[model samples]
Target: MTDLLLNHRVEGSASAPPLLLGPSLGTSYALWDAVAPELSIGHRVVRWDLPGHGGSAADLIGPGASVGDLAGLVLRLADSLGVARFAYAGVSLGGAVGLHLAVHHPDRVASLAVICSSAHFNGAKPWQERAALVRAEGLAGLAEGANSRWFTAGFTVQRLVQDHREADPEAYAACCDALAAFDLRDRLTEISAPTLLIAGREDPATPPVHLREIADAVPGAALLELPGASHLAPVQCPEAVLTALRTHFDGAAPRGMEVRREVLGDTHVDRAQARQTPFTARFQDFISRYAWGEIWTDPTLSRRERSMITLTALVAHGHYDELAMHVRAARRNGLTPEEIGAVLLQTAVYCGVPAANSAFATAQRVLAEEED
Candidate 1:
């Protein structure tokens, strides 16, 4: 389709890299609120509400739309933003989206992080039956059983249950149908991005073994088994999730750095390197380690989106020096001349005419020099 209307919010410094966060079927984008603040500090986190949930219309997806179709909707969003590639992380049905993207749209994915999710969530029969039940009785019918399966030992089910209870019945049913049809075990090896697979040992929904199957299939993928955690491990044991993300993103040769060099150019990088004295060394190190290495490398977001965020933040902060560098980077990241003008024009409204004028001046100069 030409456009997808699923509700989404992009937060963090416009200068930060873009990270896409997908919610599970029953919940809204609020599912990531706990971890978003920490992540947003380093990433332009894009939280999207699932279809028929939160701000999305209940019928945003038709009866035939599968997880692959859902992936298509996400890529459409990226295209609209002029984001050439991004990192992605999702839970449950959201995780299935990461899988589909990594398998089918590998070129657009920088990294893939799957949390408390599954490749094939149970057999099709259970999902079909759940879909039928919800269609007949609405989301209220699935609340109790779903709550029981999603958490463990002393964990309160009130909030999680509420997420399901408030869901749109028809949309929930469509998600169930999507799960019923999703099974990508055969194509696991096709995934090219750096991948992180997380599982909750206590999760009955998609147990650790199911996650192990995925881990075993995808070469070089790291699997972290969070002990005593349940299906909602991200909410139940968030620390484990954060730690794993850091380790994955902060590795020796981070995926983010590769994209960074590609976007920023060797001339810029060499200049930055030339100025890295001891005083400036730590400053550069922190950016490379945390900002570029960790946050940028997150398979959960994209490099193109990151360039956009950085450009916007520079405009907002009136940091024309950085803005000029990123203006050049933005083009390399696939922002068209027209698109870059649009970003600056939007900045004029929110940031001010002066900031945008400066940005436009720098961007126009860079575009002209490249043309020459």
Candidate 2:
């Protein structure tokens, strides 16, 4: 391991919770320029440049490096800053480092957010080829095409492109070697940190499906997909990325909103938010913080079990409208239609036939809508 420290910029009050932001390959911490200041309002935000990418030493890592090596450097940097545990967010290769840390060093990561990154990076053959090309011809060619890979067709961040062009070729190649060797797909289920994933719908490099794969494996993980974004989401859609990060790493209400969106789905939650009034706002906040955040987020009960209990309670009270909504949630929690029917059938014996009858009708309608 290299003893040289990574170059970093710290923001916000030192007393606040520490948040470490990592950059993607070819770009520096400057990639977070649009969003870091706002994040620093409530967090001790530390943005770091990758070795050879910005102000960090090019020799910090050699050609045979791995994502674990990058994560080690980040842990060392955090240790130097007296940050024992922190909320971490990263883009692309930087995101891979976050994944490695969450899997191998869970005690050091309080929470994790992976933006436009994947667990395996498509099996590494492509990264190996890119590493070879960069080693031989340098970053100019890649920088020329950076706009295409990192953003949508007519939306380029000049500073980021220039950072790509100016990156140290040997160090960049070493990063590529790390990417070529990185694969955390099998270890995703082992993550214990509260996790969030943001994906650029337009990103061809590591698309939304990549984020979805991680969300599927990590228990209670949440995902947000940006419509106009590509690989460098924070640069391309700062407001959207900032909002997601805030909700993921902030107070109990924000945490509740994230879990609400995850379990009920975005469309349902968005509609609820839109319909909230001044009189209802407090109630909404209470539900988010108390019911969704504190209750639903409790890991002691699997979401599937919660769905079962919620379904039974709703039926017992003859809350068919709420039952319909939870029917969809039960499906999302991995309950088969037959299993849902079984749950309702059991409820009939205790909740009474009339109540179960209404619930079965509501559930049937909801399940049919899902099939369509």
Candidate 3:
């Protein structure tokens, strides 16, 4: 069932660390149905439809609502649910909102994951024309444009039925307004939360160059570009996204050299440890070899640098699930809250105020948890 007031669905325990899922522009919470099951294993999942998008009240931001206002609505929804702090994940416009929350309302977020979003949507005239068309007609008027940029032709052919072609017109127009007014290239370094940035390699809407700028600007962000995915990578390649999330989250715990030694290096191995449950054995192998050996051992980038790059990419592309995991990893990698803030400030120009504002709020929430 849905929460009538907040326009959200709650699945899993209230006591668990809340995971707030934000939908992309023009879409509803149904976008998260596939991934929510995987995430619900450990966290309470709260998926919300932004105002004017799904079951929420139909008040558009009028003509002046900012991305920060959208973010504030999310915070209000969480407060309504008694969620003091939560890990946030979002896609597209939702990702922008998550970044604002991290940068400005850091105390409310525990981690951030952003997907297929951009800090700045660029200044192309064609995009503006399309937005005008959507405003004058409806989302249907922009469906072709949205589909071309959002999905690979092959994927769209196969999965067209699942896409949000029937989404609300007013919601789509409001989101276009949010994107149009967003600019945060000068404020990338102000965000202090750890962030993970996930991108679809084939995403034409927010290309690799945008992600590169984000990676370069955010202090402790990491970037993971998934091949064979389009703008909606979370839906197109949920397995890879799940793997990355699991690795980042589990990697946040403090592991002594002794634990590392026992697992990977030469150290005493107890016979009883060998007889542990199959799940435990699999987890050990996953962590030691996949997480540590493959990711942690990569010499191309230091963990600290990776953290910075990841946060920037998240701010750029707006991948909120990975953003949260990276925020937690930033703490493990020794990044301070102030450094995160600096990154958000630096990225303000390239990404935009809406994206940066969300990044800042998410950072604040994650950093506050670290203090607690």
Alpha-carbon shift of residue 244 in model 1 (angstroms): 1.0
Q: Per-residue lDDT for 263-339 in model 2, tens only?
A: 99999998987675434555676788789989999999999999999999999998888999999999999999999
- Residue 52 in candidate 2 has what lDDT? 92
For candidate 1, the C-alpha RMSD (Å) to the true structure equals 15.7
Q: For this target, which candidate reaches the highest lDDT against the unseen true structure?
A: 2
Q: Write down the lDDT of every candidate, Cα atoms only.
A: 0.80, 0.92, 0.71
State residue 134's C-alpha deviation in candidate 1, in Å. 0.8
What TM-score, computed on C-alpha atoms, does each candidate reach? 0.67, 0.69, 0.65
On a 0 to 1 TM-score scale, where does candidate 1 land against the true structure? 0.67
Ranking by lDDT: 2, 1, 3
lDDT of 2 at 347: 95
lDDT of 2 at 314: 96
Which candidate comes out best when scored by TM-score?
2
